[model samples]
Target: MTKEEREQIATCIREEIETLRETVARLEDSAKTVDLDQPIGRLSRMDSLTNQGISGKVLAESKRRLLGLERALANVDDEDFGHCEECGEPIPVRRLLIMPEASLCVDCAE
Candidate 1:
């Protein structure tokens, strides 16, 4: 891929990471905003906890994504970004655009 294209992909990943971080922060803030046992609040608070749990999962997934993006970017620097780590062939640019963290090309992945 072109250098500009690679930079654009990196920018997109960074923006996504920032957005997920904000979502996680908001979930945490909402989770802490109410008491857990008040009559009008019990079930609702539980619901908040549920949302927080989901958000926490998203947060974890986002963190994993950021790590992968870092590795992918490093691969770019090392001139190994577009090659499948497992089989040593070129990875399609389309696939990389769709999933920048992919370490294996489609054949290897399958």
Candidate 2:
């Protein structure tokens, strides 16, 4: 990839990592604030617990993506940064723009 392209991808990844971190922080705070012993009814507490579970799952996925983005940033200048890991083919720039952390091409991802 060209130097400019690599820089662009790195920027995108960094921005995404920042956004994901903020979201994960917010989710963590929300999870912490969930109170089961409040004056709310049983159904309300159950609903809160269910929402907490969903938020936890989403937070985990976001953190995983954040890690992936950080790895992409670290390898932004690697010779194979934009290549498909499974096929050793060039991953399209458009795809890379959409998913800066992707390591597999569309066909391999399927």
> Taking the candidates one at a time, how many backbone clashes does each contain?
0, 0
lDDT of 2 by residue, 12-32 (tens): 888898899999999999999
Candidate models: Cα lDDT each: 0.74, 0.91
| Per-residue accuracy of model 1 over 15-80 as CA lDDT, tens digit each | 665765676677667657656566666677678778777777776776677678767766665567
Q: Name the best candidate (by lDDT).
A: 2
**lDDT of model 2, residue 108:** 97
TM-score of each: 0.71, 0.94
Q: Could you tell me the lDDT of residue 5 within candidate 2?
A: 84
Q: Model 2, residue 32: displacement in angstroms?
A: 0.5
Model 1 segments beyond 4 Å from truth? 1-40
